[model samples]
Target: MYLDINGEQFRILKAESQGAWLVSCDAPGPPRFVDQRELDAYPRAPAPEPCTAEQGEAPQTAAEQARMALIQPLLDNGDCVSDPAIRRQLAAEAAQEHGTTSRRVLRLYYQYIATGAVMKHKPRKRRPPEYENYYKRAIQTFYYSAKRPSLRDTYDLMLHQFFTAPDGHLADKRPTWPAFRHYFYDQAYHRRSERTIARDGLTNYQRTARPLTGSAMTWKDHIGAYQMDATTADIYLVSRLDRTKVVGRPYVYLAVDTATQLIAGLYVGYEAGEEAVMACLANAAMDKVEYCRGYGIDIDAADWPSKGLPSEVITDQGRDFLGGRMKELCLRYGVTCEALPPFRPDRKGLVEKMFDLMQGRYKPILRGRGVIEADAQERWAVDYRAQASLDLTQFTQILIHCILYLNGRRVLDSLQMSPEMLEQGVAPTAAGLWQYYAAAGKSALLELNPQEVYYMSLPRKT
Candidate 1:
């Protein structure tokens, strides 16, 4: 005996004292026994009338005909259509015959079953948004401001400000909140940088919203171009003379080779300006073996191979880089000085990124030893200055190790290896790349006299 339960057809196989053994006629599964009491409790409904397709309203397009053909077998067998297992098997066979997925075949079957029209299988066209001009003007004027107003608040303000009658009464045909929100998000998505600059300010936009297109590898033909930049180390340092006195954070200057991504030079000190730049350049010109030895770090010359003067130095328009002393030194050494325009740190992104990479390596290990936490500026934050345990020399030693690790051991997955280098199975490390290129005589390193470089790098006493 067949009965419809909750819109699904089921067949009773046998009646027992306590329950009746039943199997679903609309879905495929093993026979299930239902309690006699529960069976009586279900409301009985006449089976739904079979969905029939309109006679003259046949499929018009090839896609519609194809969809109808895919679902025709399931429609022909009404009993199997109700049994999920049988239905799935039929759909899978149809899918394989038609070169389509079973899921797509099943979806077509359900679509035809519901509407009895193959045309319903086609996707509907998307309509363009009909946002009024006043709505967009209002969003631009009020929504994209430093005040950072919400979409709802902006809509409310627009209704009162623009969508009002001449006599100050609310207009009957104002834009809805839902429409305003949709339009705002649409505009924000399309004009992300503009929205960010207007709402969060230009600095925030430059830092987070600016589009990154080109890479520093654009200058990867040679190792002569060095990008120079300065940043204050996050950790506070104590004075070497007096361990009790907190000497504040040290200024770190790094000169990075664009082609090989090597740390060509570095300077960590309390001084800022031309003096620091000169000192860093002097270090870049001299051999690093003796410099490491001075810091009690014994290493092979090949370990820290980056040395000699760069052909061109790229820096931001800082007063130090723009000073006469810098110009004089660069002119004397025939080094091209390219100071980037204001608010354009993205031009020297390699050196800028290196600062973060170098600091991130050591900051985790030196946490309580004076590394400043992100929340150090917040109210009731820890006194990071008092936590200073590392002096200048100690911090320098740590920085040297970090630089050595980055140059010699750290793998740069983004580093583009030449065909020759790849053929030789060269490691994608800064030192590895530098050594490979230098050995090939493609190095742009100028072997300047150490004494002349040192004397020229010293601040001129007029």
Candidate 2:
């Protein structure tokens, strides 16, 4: 007999004298004990034809046992019987000799030989939920259509709604507490219920739910795709023109290669508008050999060969990123500017994660008024602006140093190697990847007039 509990099917392994049936289910873990009354709800299947295997035969593999069971009777008695009573007697004797239940022995000897295949049980059709249509609608509206509410509170509210029905009648029936809990907390509405909370709802779904079934777009080469993003620096800075005058937090824009987690270009300044993005792109496109020399850092042109426009640039839906000017600039450079959906940082996670790593590295070192604590104002009780000593030039030098170290030394968890190592396959630094890609005939980098692309990327007054 099959045991059907809440649309699940289980096979009866043995019947206990205490009115309980030991059943085995397909679900993970061990067998369970089910009451006899619950077991009686399911219908019994028809018995299979009897097998002629010897009663004292040793246990064997499914195929071996099946072969023995099928031809043993012909070998012993020259014929098989069609009598059910005789089959039951044979099954009982076989069970005792094999030290197993009679039902299992009969099932294997009859079903396994007849089918000639392994059988896996299929679940039965599920019955409808206890709640009516209107109640379901109400639950959906409260739980999914709005901020997440406590399951207990939802249950209490549902009970109240039932008692205060418009027709002045209470709900006819209520489900058991276990049943209600299972439906809401352990089934379809299980862990997904937390996604309805209002705190950064779109970001929460993008970060948690979307990633489970989503994939990152792949690129054929190193410079094939570049991800750009902007974030406010946690630490405060002072003006480069005047060291005594303190500037507010600056916006840092970064462009990272998608194939390798290499930072191609970066810009740090007071404004986070389209102009900053333009500056960042220009930095990425133009040779940084001269730019680095200006800071007394001597570098050959081959040391940082990451210059040249990428085939595609992906950025989030910021005002600067979504503007038509960005697309026009990409058109001029033979590139594509793709804006990701609003509030989705995962699409541009390469750049966003870099910003987080930068913050973690820099914030602790430059502790003063620049600390990112909520009670920073109260705890320090000092003017952060006055305490800020790192001028823009000094900060820029420090940032460049950090980037160089990251490109050369930092190992990545995802790749099990540094970005530089993965990019070059042999290079010890990101510059090696740059040189190798530049040498390859299939480079996706485009030659462009920086002055022209910069002008086009700037928003025009309509």
Candidate 3:
């Protein structure tokens, strides 16, 4: 039961035939006995709803238990604990024993008595601003954009727009700059993704802020799902017919098998369009032994065994991959073509990563022999074009060597091997995994005529 005595509120702690004990509900104190006649003089208030042990309560920590134990004696003293001198002596004794201050001990005792639990003494949550929506609208209008203004500038603009009087003077009752800054950061913390996209553009957000939880292998079940993309090689090349003639950097197309992390096929050429893509597809469908032999390199079929058209090809939404020729080729070959969403290169990360590995392997040895340095674009930098020495054929041969090494010998530490493969002692190299899967009849390779695929992939004028 509760009572309203004058303006103070008290809760009934105990009721006896002679009198009743009441405690102040608003503050911590021991209960005081009041005569029945005096209690009847106060107005009764409706009882507050009962709070269960589990209601809005968290388990107490070790520190809270220790603190509560230290103050147990003071709380047991009843009304004597409210006396300043007596309470001070009790707090000092507990503080001396527990290595805490007397003030803290007294505060904790009062808190526990008022709330009935140490966990209920948490700091109160701050109230939001009354004009929260106005601040949010101002931030959205003047701050979260490609032309991002500073918070100070944003606040100034907001004041000019929303807090200006009709006479063009600033209103006296306006939010402070610190308040606006606090609210701005609070909103930004919660709307991180939305703020990044709005201020830095979607491409930048996808590249930097987006979470990388999914792997490229998630979309592939076998070796036939290939990720295809093109990148400009960092090295410059000369014309095949004349080594003295300096040609520009060539575009290199790569096809990577998602399941085995294998470089299925590659092409180095002057074009970055449908021609280069079709040529790469032709190379993938043909036997690698003959292709390496054309460059005067002899390799066993087992060394570079990846061949045949893939069941599905994943690529970015580039003009080369979205052209009519690409669609016609997929339709004729019964291949499913998947174009990734714009600015989402992580979808085809296998082929994108292959470009880096392929270029990094040869760049060190080929420096000053046509390889462009990182600062080539700076003023007074070396003329990388004049240093070009390797012709198209020589560059192609170097790339083939790198590809052979990657396919046959590179150890894949992150490869996930099945129990059967592990028991069979299958190596973790690309070729080892491919050969094992092929022998187990788990490969998705389609046996098509090499000459037919080559001729059909050739770009013809409409």
Q: Which candidate number would show the highest TM-score if scored against the true structure? A: 1
Which portions of model 2 miss their true places by more than 4 Å?
Answer: 1-142, 161-188, 193-204, 213-222, 298-303, 322-328, 374-383, 416-442, 448-462
Instruction: Please provide, for model 3 over 1-462, each residue's C-alpha lDDT reduced to its tens digit, 9 standing for 90 to 100.
Output: 678887777777567798787766566565567999999899997543221232224437887678777787787775443366787888899999989898888777655544455545447556466568768888788887789888799899999999999999998888889888887777674367877888889898888789877666656667888899998999889887887898889989999998888899788888778877888888998999999999999999988898898888889899997787778777887888898898888778878888888888999999999899989999999999999999888999999999888888899877778899999999899889888878887777777877776675566887
* Per-residue C-alpha lDDT of model 2 across residues 119-199, encoded as one tens digit per residue: 333576453554644345545656554556766666666776654577766656664445556566545664553434442
Alpha-carbon local distance difference test for all models: 0.79, 0.62, 0.80
lDDT of 1 by residue, 345-413 (tens): 877888988999998999999999888999988999999998998999999999999999988998888
Error of model 3, residue 217, in angstroms? 0.6
Best by lDDT: 3
Error of 1 at 38 (Å): 17
Error of 1 at 322 (Å): 2.4
**Rank ordering of all candidates by TM-score, starting from the highest:** 1, 3, 2
In Å, residue 117's CA in model 2 sits off its true spot by: 31
Question: What is the TM-score of each predicted model, taking all chains together?
Answer: 0.72, 0.58, 0.63
